[model samples]
Target: MTLPLEEDSRPPYLQAAEVLRTEILVGDLAPGSRLPSARLLQARFGVSSSTVQNALRVL
Candidate 1:
């Protein structure tokens, strides 16, 4: 089986930030709720910690 692979349309940091921000805006993820740690985001996004932080910085 061939699994589909795709490249990110936006920057990694931007994508990560938007995901969390959207969750916050939609109430899917509430404020003051413990967010996934940098390590977690790092693993999830497969990006560097700085990249995850850049996204969070947007919030």
Candidate 2:
């Protein structure tokens, strides 16, 4: 699940959250499903743990 990070004014956390929210809305991520671990998310998104946490908060 490698998603390209867009170059825009939005913060990295918001961008990550948007990607995740889209997946949920599109049914790619089913309701009540377990989300990937923060470490995995950080590696996948090339972001820091804090960024992943912020993204999860947004979700």
Q: Pick the candidate with the highest lDDT.
A: 2
Task: Please give the range of 10 consecutive residues that has the lowest summed lDDT in model 2.
Answer: 1-10
Candidate 1 positional error at 7, Å: 4.2
Native RMSD of candidate 1 (Å) = 4.4
Cα lDDT tens digits, model 1, 1-59, are 11111555677777777777887899988877988898887887777889878888987
lDDT of 2 by residue, 11-48 (tens): 88998899899989999889999998999999998999
Residue runs of model 1 more than 4 Å from their true location after superposition: 1-7
Instruction: Give Cα-based local distance difference scores for all models.
Output: 0.75, 0.88
TM-score of each: 0.74, 0.87
